[model samples]
Target: MVDHLIIFTRYPEPGRTKTRLIPALGPEGAADFQRQLTEHTLRQVRSLQQRRSLRVTWCFSGGDVAAMQGWLGSDWDYQPQAAGDLGDRLIAAMHNAFAAGATTVAFIGIDCPAIDAALLDQAFHVLEAADMVLGPADDGGYYLIGLCRPVPELFQGIDWGTAVVRQQTEAIAQSLQLSSHLLTPLNDIDRPEDLPLWDAVQRQMLSVIIPVLNEAGNIRPLMEALQQVPEIEVIVVDGGSQDGTAAIAQTLGARVLFTNSPRACQMNAGAAAAAGGILLFLHADTRLPHDFPTAVRQTLDGAHVVAGAFDLGIQGARWGLRWVEWGVKWRSHLCQMPYGDQALFLRAETFRSVGGFAELPLLEDMDMVRRLKRVGRVAIAPGRVSTSGRRWEKLGILRTTLLNQLILLAYHLGVSPNRLAAWYRDRNFSK
Candidate 1:
C-alpha cells in the first residue's frame, strides 16, 4: 500500500498562533514552545523513516511553502491547510492524500510527543484488520487518525475541538459500517504543567564570516545581532583596520582574526578557521534575513545545488533605491549571480573542494560565482539582504551605478584586477 503520513501544523508566528498557551508562556514564549513541539515531532518522523518507506506530507498553515521549507528544511511536501473548521481541513487533507495514489494514510499533529515510531507502526498494523485506526488523546480529542481508504462521510458533521470528538468519529464509523481500532491514549500538552515533558532537540551550527576594513562604527552592532542567534558562531576577519575594528569585534565576543590580505583572502582565512559544517560569507554592513539559518540550509538542500545567496536590498530613502533593488533581484535570478553583499553561504566541504574564494581585490565575488556555477546550480533565496547604502549616498546613485557597470565591463574585457583595484582606490568614496 502507498503509506503516507501527513502532519498538520501552524507556523509559530507570535500572537497569531498557540494563543491558549500565551497566558503561561507569553506571546514569544508560546511561539518558541510551538517551534519546540514541531521539531520534536519531526525527530520522531525521522525515527519512523528508519523503519518504513512512507511519504511524509506537511499540511501547514500561517506561512508560504518557501517559509515552511526555510523553517523545517526542504524534506517534506508542504501543502496549505484548507479553509474552514478543523474537521473541514482534515477532510481536505485526507482527500488530497488518496488522490495522490495513497492506499493507506495516517494524519497527526505536533500536539502529542507520545506518538512514537512504534505507535505509528501499530496504527498501520491495525489498518490490516480494521478500516480505520484512532489514537485517542488524554484530552477529549484524538491525537491521530488513520484510514485504509477514503471514508469522507466519517469526517462530516462532527463537533471538532471538543471532548466528544472521539465519540462522534466512532459513531460516524459505525454508521458507515467501517471497522475501527483504537490505540492507547496519549496526552496533549495544553496547560503549563505539561511543559516538563518536552525533550531537547539539537540544531545545526552556522558559521558566519565577515571581512572588514576600518568598520569600527559598524562591527559592534553587527556582532551583537549575530550573537543573539543560537548555534551561530561569528568570525570577523580584519585586514589591518586602523579604526580599531578588530578590537571592537573581539570585545563584542566574536572570534577575531587578523589578515593583511585583500577581501577574498581575508574571507578565505576566516573560512579556514570556521568550526561549523556550513559557512556563510557575510559583508560587514549587511544584515541577513531573520530566518537565515533555515533559508541557507534549505536552499543548499536542493538537488544539484551546492551554494546560494540572498537577493540584495540597498538601505536608503532615495526613490532610485527601489530601482536598484529590482535590478539586483533580476540580476541575481537571470544571471544566477550574486555579490558578496548578498551573503553567500554553502557547505564547508563544497567550499573547500572549490578552493574557497579566489585571492583578488576586485571582482572576486564575481569570479567565485562564475567558478561555482560550473560545479552546481546556485539558489537565490527570496528575502533580500540589506546592505549599507553609504557608497551610493556619497557617489550619487547614477555615478555609482555607472562606475560599477563600467568596472564589470572592463574586468570582462581582460583588464587585470590589480589595475581595477588601483582605479577603485583613486575614485573610492572618501567618507
Candidate 2:
C-alpha cells in the first residue's frame, strides 16, 4: 500500500500568490522568498528516509506548472491543480492520491521550515491509531492534513484561511464520527519578524577549543588517551605552563597555542585563535572515555543539535565515585544539563555568538552549559569522560555533593553571583 505525500505549492510568480507577504517583501523579493520556501520544503521532504511503501508527489497550482517544476527539480513527480475553490483543489488532490493506490494520503503547504523527520513520523503514527490527522499551523492555516480512510464529509463546508480551520475540522470529524488525531502546533515561516529567532537558533552550533594551563602532571597522560582516537586535533591553549604542558601536547601530535591565563580568559582566547567546525571545552585534568571522536562526530552531524556532552566518570573505582557518576548521568539526562567536566561541545558559530565562556573564576563551565541548553538539544551520550575525582576525594563525597547541589539550587533561584562567590570563598574545602 503506497503511503502518499502531496505537497501543495502555488506558482512562485510575482502577482500570482502569497500576496500578503508582498507589502513587506515587495514583488521580486516575495517571489524570491517563495522560491526559497519551496526549495527548503522540498529538501526537507526529500530527506525523509525512503519508507518502502511511501511515495511523494507535488501538486502545483495557479497555472504555472513549469515554474513549480523548475523549483521542485526535474526528479519530482508533479500534477497541475484541478479547478474549483481551495477546498475543491484539496479534495481532488486527496482523491487523486487515493486513486494512485495510496491507502493513506497526507498533504503539506510550502511553508514551515521546522517540519522534519520527527513530525512526519508523528503523522504516520497517528494514521496507525486514527482515521485522519490534521497538523495545525500557527497562522490559522493547516500546514498538513491527512486521511487514512476517506470521509469526504470531513473536508466539506469548512471555512478556509481562518482560525476556525483546525476547530471546524475537529467539529466535522466529531459530527461525522470520524477518528482524528491532532499533531503539535508549529510556527510557520510566514513573516520577516520570525527570521531573527530562527537565525539565532541556526547559529548556535560552535566548534570546541581546549586551553591547557599548568598541566605537566596531566598533559601527556591526557594526550596519550586522546591519541587512541582519530581525526580529532586537540588544540592546546597554553597559558605559559612552565611545566612543559605545551611541549608535551605538541609532542603527542596536538595543535598547541601559547597564551596566558586566568582559566576562562585563556579558553575564550583560544576559541578566538582556534580553527574547527565545532568547539569543545575540555579541562586539562579530565580524560575522555573511549570512542570520544565518534561521540563528537555524532553531536556535530546535524543542524538541529546545537551542543552536547557525555556522561562523566572518574579514573578511579571508589563506590562514592561510581555513585557520583550515576547521579551526574541521571541529572544530565533528566535536565539536559551536561556540565563541562563531562566535556562541553558546541558548534563553533554558536560558541562565538554567545561570546564564549564568561570570564568567571568559578562556575564558568556550568554557566556556559546552562546558556547552551536554550539553543538546541543539549544531550548526554552514553559515552563518558573519566575525570579525576581528587576534588571530591579531598573534600569528601558527601560534602562535595551537598555543596554542589546547594550551589546549583542557588544558581537556579537567581541568587546574586557575588554572594554565591563569597559563600564559596568562605568555605575552604580542598580543591
Candidate 3:
C-alpha cells in the first residue's frame, strides 16, 4: 500500500540555505532564492498529496518546525529535521515514519523546481509493488526516494555527495534482494548555468574528450596533481610539442606517447597507452581533487559500472570560483554526470572494452561516454578537477555555454567529426 510522503527540507535562512551559491549570489540573494524555491516545491508536493490517501509529512530543520506550520497551513504534519548529515536525517525520518504505521515512505527535497505533480504520482504508484523507487536528479542525487519495505542496508555507508550514491545504494539493494524502480530524471539548479537547462536534467551524459596542444607550461602541475591520486594513471600523448612537453613529461614520470597532429589522435594514442583499468583523458591544465583516486577505484570495483568524471573548477585562486565550485560539485552529485574538464575517468577495461576515444576532432568525450553508458553505469562525483576557465572568461559565459551546447547537439545528432572540428576552430577557444 502507498504510505507517507516525506518532504525533506531545512529552514530557508540567509546563511544556511545553499551557502555554496552564496559565492555567486551573495548570502541574502541565495537565501531569498531558497525561500521562493522552497515555497514553489511545497506547493507542488501539496497538490500531489491531495490525490492519494498518502500522508504528507514535512521534515524540517535549521529552525523550529513550527515556523513552517503557517507556510504549509494546519492540515499537513510537521516534524523537525534530526541533527545529522543528510543520510542520518533521511534514515531517521524513514524509520520514524515506518514505526508510526507508515508501510511505505517517500522522501524528496525542495531544490528541484521542475519536479511536478505527475512525477510524484508515478513514484507513489510504483511503490505499491517495488521495494524502492528513485527519481534520479540530473545532479546525481535523487529528487524522490521511496521505499515500501524497509531496507535498512540501503541507508548505510555511502559517500553521500559523490557519484556513487545511487550506485552504492543499488548495490546494497541487490545484495539484499530488494526490488526497485526508477523515474524519469529532473534537473535541480545548484549553479548559475543550470538556470538555463533546468528542464532537461532527465537526459543522458555526453562524454567529450578535450585534447591539449602545446600546453607545455600547464602539463606538469596538472600531471603532478593527478599522480598524487594513485588510482589515476596519466597518459600524455604529445603531438610533437616543440615546447619540450615530452621531455617535461618524462622528467615528471608521466607515460608519454608520440602522436601525429589532431587532438583526436593524441587522445586515442593516450588511451591506447593507458595502463589503468580505466583511461582518463585529462587536459594538461586540469587539477583533480585529492580523493579522486578512491572514488575512481571504488567505481571500478562495482559491477555494471563503466566510466565517469568529477565536477569542474578553475586552475587558480579566484574568489568567483566559489560559485562554480558549488555549482559543478553539486551538479555532479545530483546528475551523476561530470564534465570533461572534470578529468573523465572510466574503467581501463571498459575504455578498451568499449573501443576507447573515437577519432573525432571534437566531441570525442561525448561519443565515448554514450558508448560507456550502454555497457554499465556512468557517474559524476563530488570530487572536482580544476580546469582553465580562461576561455569562458574571455569568450563570455553566454557565448561559450551556447557554443558548447550547440556543438554537443550536433555531435549527438551524428554530425561528422570533421565538420564539427571546422566549427570548433572557428570559435577559437584557447587551451
Candidate 4:
C-alpha cells in the first residue's frame, strides 16, 4: 500500500498541446508555458516526496522514454499514456495505479495552477470519508482527480472537454450512492487571457564557456565534469579545429559553436550566445574542482566582488609548477586580477557592461581585468581549477615563466597586442 502522485502532461511540443493561447503567445510561447508548468509541478511533487513516505511518477504523452529523459530528467518513474481520448487515458491510468498496489493515487493535469502539496494531502485525507476526490475547474471541467480504488463508472458516460463535466460526474456519484468531495475550484491556463500567471519569475543558469583550438584530446572529460554540476550549461567554442573537437563535444552533450576568430573573440561570441545568467569562462584543458558552485555563489554574493576565479592547480608533477600556481594565487589576491586560465567567472550583466573581452589576440585577459577593477573588486574562490601543463612541458618552467613576465611587461609598457601575439606565436611554434 503506497501513495503515488502522478502528473499527466504532454512533452511540450509547439502548436500541439496548448493551442488555445497561440494567438496571444505564439507557438513558441505556448510550448514554453506548457514545459514550465510541467517542470513547476514536478518540482513541487519531488519536494513533497523527499520528506514524506510517498512515490511520484510522470504519466506523460507526446514523447517516448528517451525523449522525456532528455527534456526533464531520469530521476522519476515514467509511463506512456494509453491510446484514445483524455477520459480513456485517465481511466486506464487510475486502474493501472490500483492494480499496482497503490493505497491512494492522485493525478493532476499540467494546466492547473492551484494544485499544491497541501491540497494533495487533503485529497488523501478526504479519501477516508469519500470514495473519490475531484478538484473542480472554473471552466466547469476538473483539474485534478484521485481515488482510493478504481471507479470505472465515474469516468464513463461523461463528455470530457465539455463544460458540464464536473456536474455530470457529481450526478453520477449521487446515482451510484458513492460519497465524494470537491476541492477548491481552480482556473487552469487554457486560453490567451490566462498568460499572466507565468511572469517575471527568473531562472538562474550558469554557462561554462570553454574556448578551444584543436583541443580534441581534452574536450570529453571537461564536458563530463561540468555536466555533473546542477545549473551549469557547458559550451565549447571552437576556433577552426580540424580535429573532431566539435563532434566530440556535442557527443558529450556540450553545445558547440565554431569560429575562426581568436580565443578572446570566440569567448565573447560564446558568451553572447549563452542563455545563462552567469558566465564562467573556462579553458578547454581545465578541470573544475568540486563544490565550485557554492564557492562561486558565496564569493559573488558579496557587494564588493563583481567577479571571481578559482584557485589554480597546474596539472603536472614538476615541483616548479607548484610555484607557478602560487604566483597565480598571489597575483589574484594581492593584485586583484587573474588570467583566463584561472577559470574566471562573472555575472552576465557585468561581463556585458565591461564591453566583453577585447578582440585583441593577446593580453585580453589582463585587459579585461583592468576594466573589471574599475567597476568593483574581484575575488578568488577556495576551490581550484586544474589546467593542463602541456604548455609548461613544451617550454621549460624558467623559460615559460620568463616569457610570460616579459610579455606582461611589454603590454604594460604600451606594446601593441598584435606585436605581443606575433612574438608569443613565434615561441609556441611547435605542437
Identify the candidate with maximal lDDT: 1
Instruction: Quantify all predictions' global Cα lDDT against the true fold.
Output: 0.84, 0.72, 0.69, 0.80
Q: How do the residues 1-431 of candidate 1 rate in per-residue lDDT, one tens digit apiece?
A: 78899999999999977888899899998987787677657656765776778999999999899988766766579999999988889899999999999988999999886677789888877887889999998778899999989888877888887899899999989988998899999888777777655432222446799999999878887987775554466788998899999877866656688887688889999988775668899988999889798898888889999789998888989999889888988888998898888999888888898989889877788998898999998889768788999999989999988999999999999999899888998997432
lDDT of 4 by residue, 220-253 (tens): 8877676555435667899998999988887665
**Candidate 4 Cα misplacement greater than 4 A, ranges:** 1-203, 429-431
TM-score of each: 0.54, 0.49, 0.47, 0.65
Number of backbone-clashing residue pairs for each candidate, in the order shown = 0, 13, 20, 0
Per-residue lDDT of model 2, residues 1-431, tens digit only:
56788888877788766667788778876776666556556545644633334687888876555654444545567889878777888888888888878888888987775676568767876787789888888777688888896667766888876778888888888887878887888877666775553354234323346677677888888777665443343567887787888777765655566666656887887777544456778888887767665677676665677778888877677798889888888889888877778888876777887778888756778888778777777877557787888888777888999998898799779887667777886887423
Task: Judge candidate 4 against the unseen true structure and give its global Cα lDDT, from 0 to 1.
Answer: 0.80
When 1 and 2 are scored with lDDT, the better candidate is 1
Model 3 misplaced stretches (Cα beyond 4 Å): 1-211, 226-233, 315-337
- Backbone clash pairs in model 1 (N, Cα, C under 3 Å; residues 3+ apart or in different chains), count: 0
lDDT of 3 by residue, 1-431 (tens): 54788887767778888777788778887776676566556546655755677888888887675667544445678899877778888888988889888988988887787777678888888988888898888777677888986666677888887767888888888898888899988777777766555323211111223255678888777655543432223456788777887766655535467878777688777665443334566777776666665665676556766767776777546565566667667756665556567777775456677777777666666667677767777776556676777776777665766787788788778788788888778778644
